[model samples]
Target: MVHLIKTQSSSAKSRMGPASLNPDLPAVAGLGSFEKLNGFFNAIYDGPTEDPPWHSALNLLCETLHAKHVTLILKPPSPVSTGILVNTDAVAHDATEAYQNHFFTLDPFVGLPEGQVVTPEELVGDKVWKQSTLYREYLKPLDVKFLIGADIQTADGIECRFRVSRGGDIPFSADDIALCRLLLPHMRRALQLHSRLDGLETERQLFAGAVNSMQLGTISLAHNGAVIDLNPEARRILAEKDGIQISNNVLCTDNRREGHELQRLIKEALSGSAGKKGPGLVEALALTRPSGRSSLGILVKEIPPSPWTVNRQRAAAVIFIRDPEASVAETSQKIVQQLFGLTRIEAAMALSLANGSTIEETAENLGLKKNTARTYLRFIFNKTGVTRQTMLVRKLLGSVASLG
Candidate 1:
């Protein structure tokens, strides 16, 4: 049986926890009920970082509170800004849109302090709530009644509000308020974790896009040489399958000698032996295709362990492949000069690199000395805030400042 006992604290008078909802009803919420809640907490973290599985977790919360519908609403600090309101039920889109567009100001529970659990009657008495336009015109038509709200958090002018509502006359009981209070901390923590994970996913996408734009193929491998991730360029290279291909989810080249060397480096990198070789030690090899296309230059390097990757087993080493035969897109020299503040010669050098020309080759094609080309490259790098040719290429290709 659930009991409510009063106890005095050093700073306050005697306070009591919530009493049972109904003494007449049997206690359905036993140890097993709490076990289910624990499961919900664990399940919230086990999914794609971009799109979290919140709907299922909300369903579990609804079951615990015996609520008809649980809705999450976010209100920006400014009235003109658009915010989000999502409901556990699918049919409330029209009602929710109306609330966002018109009735949010009339909402009795808006602007509440964080962690304050409240009910409709507490905000406005039963008579006043019934007479309000929000209740009479908007909520009554939708058959929504009896709300319990708690402000989970407010950060950077964004307020996170969570509420549970019941319909058809009966109001939320003391038990419902207590249950909401109990689960509020876990819910708030979960939302914080979700925000952090989403930020990480965004950064990962930006880095991947920059790498792909440089026309470089990047592949991440696990300790066992299993493929973990491949950028867009890597996917294209693998699709050609002239020399490099995925065999049984592991990276493999057509030539036995080079494949064996590649596997050895991967293993050595994963085992942390790569650092013993020397500083900035990277293994390089060439993949020669039988069709006589340009050879693919592959470089394998160890990724140092970090606290951010303590739980991930497959983020140990990365492979970068440069294909000499692949066609390069021509970048506009005028756009390059405007974007990077480059002189005409420097812009020419940048565009030549964008078109897959080495410094010597570009110097020969432009009828300039190699030292002149090198000097121009340094100036371009300084203007673009990069210290290396690879970074310069990445910046030029990834930037949309010159694009139509």
Candidate 2:
């Protein structure tokens, strides 16, 4: 299970990491290139965000090194099925480019020593050279003689190597390897962030798709108070021209007051001093229209970032209407288990009432007397906050349509 990280406020002493985690991580302590990276992490919660920008970091390294070809391998030890993102000033990434098909498989110097800078031979020995005869034959024509490689160990010590090969008879000097070492740690961490961000983006898209398909009005806003995503129902509720218009994350709502209030909450969340990205909560927020109509029983919670790490960006607040007039709660006991913390008997009585069953019929179904069924109905109303059977049907409609 993944636990949500609580970031320290201005009033509290800051914690770099959890007691159980690695204390030496520079990113946690806000040091070095890590400081800039940490700032970027904070920026994610400040507003809507996309995948971690990878090529920019590579561009920084490329400008510093003035290398011919800078390839960031996305796969690990598996040569057969690994992704390679090659950023070269000389070449464009045409769809038909067969780079991944040829170079990675032909490259022989892999399995480098972890946490240490090295040259080609240092990583792959005489025995490897003997085995990679085909690779040598292929390299001779290109005159590629030098490779500066090193294994970048991650925060959890997950080891992966990065190598830059120069196309010349001249060998790579010690200075070149040293520079690679200097940039390796930053590149590795950036790559990890990129991976995590990409994964989160995918999940967000899928989840958004699911939400939009549902009847519930779901809206997810970033810390910056910008509309991140909204379900079809929500879009219908807020959309001005033919549903949604995307200009500065703006929406025309019948209820401008509610819209503005939500925006304020988002702004407050963005301004939070927490190093982690999340919306903690809103204080007594009231969503209303100019007509004085309001969305009631709005429940909000800060959803943590993805449990998986590698590309790290946080998710947004998940808000729902607890006692929805627009939706019906499902009769499924499993949903009852999740929502109201009700027992099986209580859930059954609620469902029966929602189905328009009288006390005698409910008793017949439950193998009980009318008085016993009436007793269960009383408990259900108390648990679900329904005053009568008609109100219970409204709860059933609004609540049952989703098990989110």
Candidate 3:
């Protein structure tokens, strides 16, 4: 049988024990008087950077409140989506799946007044709550008797649910409610931080993926000419030890003259001497490969220092290495075709010109007459809005097609 009782007011007048003295109550499981509060706050702020994100904080809350389960609904479930949920390990996978799959819509305990903590018995009469299908079918099966929840609405338009549940006859105490109320604001702020950081991380990954797709080797260098970071392509290039290599964590070439020129360009870039008219101070050189292949094209650009940064030893420059011998991947052709609405032959001609093939050479390579090739080139120029071959080449190289 369901043990139904009216919940007491969470208001200050009815609250008792140490919680009445201070809203932030001390831990009961041998924690120093203030250690639990300190630990919870730390976990709240550090939640955004954690691997599972907010797992530690939720676990601590479950333990401190002496509840069977604590859950943070980062994203609430809807008819179309399962949404994101973070909870303590006390909830079994099958139970969680059942709630998400079926019981979520049947839940009557949702839509609590914003930032107000309340129990089902407090929100609805004890008899109504006990007779509800969510209680008799779901909560009863799980052996859950008491539940307290609060809804948090963030400035970013996120509506999160904070829920705690326990079994047996003991209901949630006023202290538990007070502690949850105290921590709600901190939870909102931490969620905001997590949202912002998550967006920035997603953007970073997108740009990094685009660069990698183009097979562009990017290297970040410190102000002292030491290599600080390298993308996958850069690592592969350096690993080959072809035209350029790393020596003592510094980019260098085996050829003495080329190495001297490389260092000079890096120094000029660092000192803001590489012509500062554009977004980044820029200079370029070609390093001779010992394998008798095409020389590797290198561009050294100064990274503008952040306004808040005063240190010079940080990442101050970036180098871009492009190997002319590397054939354009086939995805680039598809992108060019879709971008300009070009036929296969027209797209091929455009990419050939972009890669430095002469009109006659492309015509012979593709087994087309010179006049026919010129006609196709004209169609490409019309479709892409470029007048001349050089313009077409520049347009193609600088377009999103390169991102493919």
Write the candidate numbers in order of decreasing TM-score. Answer: 3, 1, 2
**Model 3 C-alpha lDDT per residue in residues 324-384, reported as the tens digit of each score:** 8776544567888999999999988888887778999999998999999999989998998
Off by over 4 Å in 1: 1-33, 43-53, 74-81, 154-158, 307-312, 327-337, 340-404
lDDT of 2 by residue, 1-404 (tens): 11223343533323433321332332222223445444434432321232223444444444444554555555552455645443435334542144455555566666666656676566567567645753465444344455566666667444555656566455655444544554566656655665566679799778765554344566565644456766666655554332123458743334556656645544544454332443553454444434444344343445445566343233355444321333332335667656776788877766666666777887898888888878877887888788888887677656733443
Model 1 lDDT, residue 206, Cα: 82
TM-score for each candidate, following the candidate numbering: 0.74, 0.47, 0.78
Point out where model 2 deviates above 4 Å.
1-53, 77-80, 84-86, 89-99, 102-106, 125-143, 155-157, 188-214, 220-233, 240-404
Q: On residues 52-155, what C-alpha lDDT tens digit does candidate 1 reach at each position?
A: 24676666667766677887764432378546665675436777777777788787766665787886667777788788888788767777777778887735
Better of 1 and 3 by lDDT: 3
**lDDT scores for all predictions?**
0.72, 0.53, 0.83
Residue 384, model 3, lDDT: 89
lDDT of 2 at 305: 54
